[model samples]
Target: MTDSSSNTQETDSSQYSVLNVNDWSENWQAGKIGFHKDIEHPLLVKYADKLTGGKSAQKILIPLCGKSMDIKWIADQGHTVVGVEAVEQAVLEFFTEQNIEYSKETLTDIPGDVYKSSDGRISVYRCDVFDFNRSYKDKFDAVYDRAALVAINRDDRERYATLMKSLSAPGSRMVIVTVNYDPALHPGPPHYVEEELIPKLYGNRYNVEILERSDSLEERWREKGLTYFDEVVHFLSDKS
Candidate 1:
């Protein structure tokens, strides 16, 4: 499901196919996740102060979190973490490497296998991110969105934003990290994320702030034969 396909038909078909738990699981079984980060993203590390505000004991929602080490960091800092990942392999790998024993059970609420790891510090639902029932909505105090938004096609951006908003409690805080790249050079899962789209998506429901914008991804993009990489870290509050 995470494959970067130039085939518009295949890509369009994925929108419907991804909703099926079995088909989505097959995508994971096929090892199609080219989007997983090898390391915890630097922006997430650098903006730790702004993202978490040195606060502990908050529950954080990580959308499309694929075996990310960021989950552990947030959990260790006294935040309970819940993440939704469509890929089964990534969820399985997360528990194996983190050395956390987990229990698998069917969630009648979401129609997927729910794996609760590390004494329930982390709960990962192996299902399409969009299919999760709204009973889970407004249950989180914070959100950590890394690659989920831009990884999706432009048409799905509003749905992504709506789902994120639903999960967040009033006055909840969120940090969104995205890379802005040129479409001509590298059409991608790391797709073009217009800066303006941020506010249009969440500003009506949240107070938005751009914490940083820099060409930090330059070295990596240059290696891929691309120029002009813009990375942004945004802090949002549900105060509005």
Candidate 2:
């Protein structure tokens, strides 16, 4: 399966059928992750300070986190990392591939199990994002969303943001990476999230700032019928 920050060669869009949300687990199980990246996202390194908001130690939440290497990078930075993934195999691959010793526990309260590093610095919950309970809201001090929103259908984008808000602490901040493109050109797993929509989604609770924009991905994804492929980075924090 592709990591959220897939750095591999881009596949022709016509080569595959549109991804169905219900088939996410199947996709992972089948190793259909052309989107996966072996390294941390450049933006995560570039805007670390802003995401952390000068806080030295934080509990960061990652939604739909596949076995991306960024989770370890975040943990290496002295912050506790909590990730949510729907596939158990993905979670296992993360720990096994990273050589991190971890223990798994079934959560009686939730539909899935919790896997944590031996040091307790990182935890990943294996469950559907919607199955995630609201009682745990306001637990994370920061959030890192890379391609998660784009991976979902348009109908679920707003619902995704609402869940993220619930997980954020009062003064939490986030670094969200999205692609800005003409949606009418190509349907996407890396969907087009127009700049205007960011405000409508997160602006009600936090101040949103556009940190950077680049068309570097046009070369890789142009075959997908994109006239322009912009990688937009945003920093969001509570209004308070």
Give one digit per residue, the lDDT tens place, for model 1 in 1-240: 433342332432232112234544665688765555667777778876666656768888898888898888777777789888877788889989888899988777766787897577888887778886443554788888887776666667899899888877776888998777765566565656777888999998888888888685546578878778787888887864
TM-score of each: 0.84, 0.87
| lDDT of model 2 at position 68 | 87
Where is model 1 more than 4 Å wrong at Cα? 1-6, 9-34, 135-138, 216-220
Report the poorest 10 consecutive residues by lDDT, candidate 1: 11-20
Q: What is the lDDT of residue 125 in candidate 2?
A: 87
Give the number of the best model, judged by lDDT. Answer: 2
For residues 1-240, write the lDDT of model 2, one tens digit per residue: 334344222334321124444467778877878678889877788898887887877999888899989899989999999999888889999999999999999987768888999999999988888777532454789999987877766667899899888888888898998887766665566777778888899999999999999675645577766677788998998997
Give me the runs in candidate 2 sitting further than 4 Å from their true place: 1-22, 134-138, 218-220
Give model 2's clash tally: 9
TM-score of 1: 0.84
In candidate 2, the residue pairs with backbone N, CA or C atoms under 3 Å apart (3 or more residues apart, or in different chains) clash, namely 1-31, 1-33, 2-33, 2-34, 2-35, 2-36, 3-35, 3-36, 6-35
